[model samples]
Target: MKRTRRRKFPPCGRVGKWASKHSRSGKHMKTKTGKKYWLFHALSILLILMLVALMCLNRGNPDFQNYSNFYWDKDDFLKRQHEMGFFWLTRLGRLLNLTYEQFYTAITGLGLFSLIAWFYRYSKYPALALAFYMVFPFLLDIVQLRNFLVMGIALWAFSLLMEAKEEPTYRYLSLSLLLLAGTIHNTAFIYIPFWLVLQWPSIWVILSSGLAFTVSLLIPRFLTEASLAQSSSHVLQRYAYLFRGQVSLPGRIFFISLSLALCLAVYFIQYSLDQDRLLEAGVKPKAFQSLSQLAKKLSYLSFGLMPLFFQSVDFFRIFRNFLPLYWLLFSIYFLVPLKAQHKRLEKLVLSLFLLGILCVTCYVLLIFSNTDNVIRTVFKENILLRLIELRGQ
Candidate 1:
C-alpha cells in the first residue's frame, strides 16, 4: 500500500547529481588529455625543426667538414669506415641529385623525428624525455650524425620490442631494424645483448649485472697489462685504443655516483610499486609494474657497465644510450605516481631528485661548453641570419 508514494528522497537526488558531475569531470579530463597529446606533438615538431636547422647550418664545425667529405669522396669514405649504411644513403642522395645540405637535413630530421615520435607514443612525459636528451647527448649527437641516426633506429626497434615482447612478428621486425642499425654503426650490435639481458628473471638480471660490474672493475687492470695491447684481435686492439684515456679520480667518482643515484631511484620506484603505493594513487598496477620492471632492468644494466666511464670519456655515450629509458622511468614512476600520492616525503624526494638533475645538467653544460669549439659553433649567430647576410654580401 505504501508503494503509492516511493518518495523522491533528497539522498537519491543528491546521488544522481553527483553521478552527473563525475561524468562531466571525466569527460573534461579526457578532453584535457587529448589536447595535451596534440600539444606535445606540436612542440616536438618545433623542437625537431630547430635542431635540424641548427645541425644542417653548422657548416664550420670540424665534424661537419669531415661528414661533408663523405658526400664527395666515396672511396675515402668507404676506406675510413666499415659501416656501409650511411654510405649507401649518400649514394641514394647522389642518385636523387640532392645536395649535401639536403641529404644531411633529411637524415638528421628523420633520426630526430623517429626518437621524438617514439617518446611521444610510449613515454608518459615526452617533454621530460626531450629535456633529458637536450641536457645529455643532444650536443654530441648533433655533431655525430651517423651515430645519431643509428640511435634513432635502435630506439625505434626497442620501442617495438617493448610493445609486443612475445609477438614473433615484432621480434623479427625489431631484429631486422637492429641489424640495419648495426650496418649504420657497429655499436648498435651492443643492444642485441642488452635486449637479451632484459628478458632474464630479476634474480638472474641482478646476478648478471653484478658479474658485469665485477668484470668492469678489472678492466683497468686489463688495460694496463701488455698482453691485452698485444692481442691479435683487431677488436680488442680497437677498444683498447678507444679506452686508453683515463678519467680523473674525481670525475670517475662523480659518474659512478650519478649511476648509483639512478639505480637507487629505480629501486625506490620499484619498492613503492611493490608496496602498492602507486595503486593507491589510482595507477593501473599492472602497467606501472611492467614499467618499473623495465626501468629496473635497464638501470641495472647501466650500473653494471658504468665502470667503463672510468676508462674513457667516450663511454659516456653508453650511458647516454640508456637515458631515454631512464627518463621514461623517472617520468612515470618518480614524477607521476609520487606526485599523485601527495605525500610530503615523496614530494621532498622529488624536489631533491630534480635538484640533482639540475646540478648534473649544469655540470654537463660546463663540460659541453669546454669541449673544443662547441660554444663557438653552437652559440654562433643564427644560421638563418648568417645565410641572409651571406646572400646580401
Candidate 2:
C-alpha cells in the first residue's frame, strides 16, 4: 500500500477558517454574526448622536436655563446641590465645567453611550437591546435629563456588579458606581436592592414581585392616613403620587389585552429557556444569572403594576425602566427556536415568527407616530439636518 503524504494542519484558529472556507462550516454563520454585531454598535452610536443633537437643538427648555445659570450666576456649586439634593451630578457639572450647553450635552451623550454599553454587554441579542434603549427611555432622557442621567449611571453600575462575579475589588467598584447614582438621583435607591438578591430564581422573583405590588398598593394609603417620620413620609410620598392620575378606559383595556399579558408570557418563556440551557450545559452559569433574576423581577412587577398604569399613563416613566426586561425577553423569544417534532411545522412557525416581528415593528412605529400629545419628538426635521450643519460649522 502506498503511503499518502499526510498534511500537518495549522493552528486551531487557522483550522476554523480553513474548514469554513473549504467544507460545510460556519463561514456564512460567522459572517452573519459579525454583521449583526456591527449593526448593533452602529445603531447605538447613531442613537447617542441623536440624543446629543436633541439636547443641542432643543436648548430652549427651562432646565437648560437652570444648567447655564448654575455656571454663570453661580456663587457656589456645593450650595446649589445641597438645596437641590443632586450632589453627584452637581459635582460632575462643577468638575467638567459641564454647565456649558456643549459640555452638558457631551455629558448626556456619554451617559447614553455608557447606558447602551451596559445593556449590550450581557444582552444575547444586541439588536433587541438597542431597540428598547431607543424606543422608550431615550426620549424621556431628553426631557428628564438629570433623572435619566442618574438612572443611566445606576444602570452602568448594575452592569458592573453583574460582571464582577466574586472579585472583591470589582464588587466594591460596582458599589461605588451605585452610590454615585443614588447621590445624583434618589430613585437609584429603588434599583440598589436587586443587586443584593441577584441570585434568586424565577419563582422567588415572581413571588417577591407580587408581594411588592401588594405592598405598593397599600403603602400609599398608609402613608396618607398614618403619622410617620418626616423622612419616611417624604419617601413614601413618591408612591403616593401613583394613584393620582387615571388613563382612559379604552387605552387601559388595550394595554392589558395586547401588551401586558403577552409581555409576561414572553418573560416566562425566556425563563423556561434559561432553565433548559442550565440543564444542558450542566455547569454552573453564574454568568447573567443576576441579570436574568432582575429581568424576571422587573417583568413580574410590571405585570403586577398594570393596574397602576391604568391610574396614570405617566407611570410609564417609572415603568419604562422595566421595559428593558421586556426587551430581553422579546429578543430571546425571537432568537431561540423551540423544539418541534415536525420539520415542516418549524417552517410554518418561522413564517409566523417573521410576521409577528413585522406586526410589532409596525405597532411601535404607529405608537410613536401617534405623538399628537407629544410637543417635542424624534421625528422632527432638525435632528439630523441641524446636527450635520452644526458639525460642519
lDDT of 2 by residue, 1-393 (tens): 999999887898998877768665466756775786577567756755665666545554435556666656455554344324454445567787555656666766777667666665555345655565566555555656667766666556655566665765767776777677666555566566655544366677667667766865665455442343333445444445555556777756755554454444554544544445432222134544555555555556565666556666655445454555445545544444445446446445644653464356335434554454222443343446556767999
Clashes of 1: 0
Q: Assess each prediction's global lDDT (C-alpha) against the native.
A: 0.67, 0.56
lDDT per residue as tens, model 1, 279-310: 43334455556556766776677778767777
Error of 1 at 146 (Å): 1.9
Looking at candidate 1, the ten consecutive residues that score lowest on lDDT are 273-282
lDDT against true structure, model 2 = 0.56
Q: List the residue pairs that clash in candidate 2.
A: 245-311
Winner by TM-score: 1
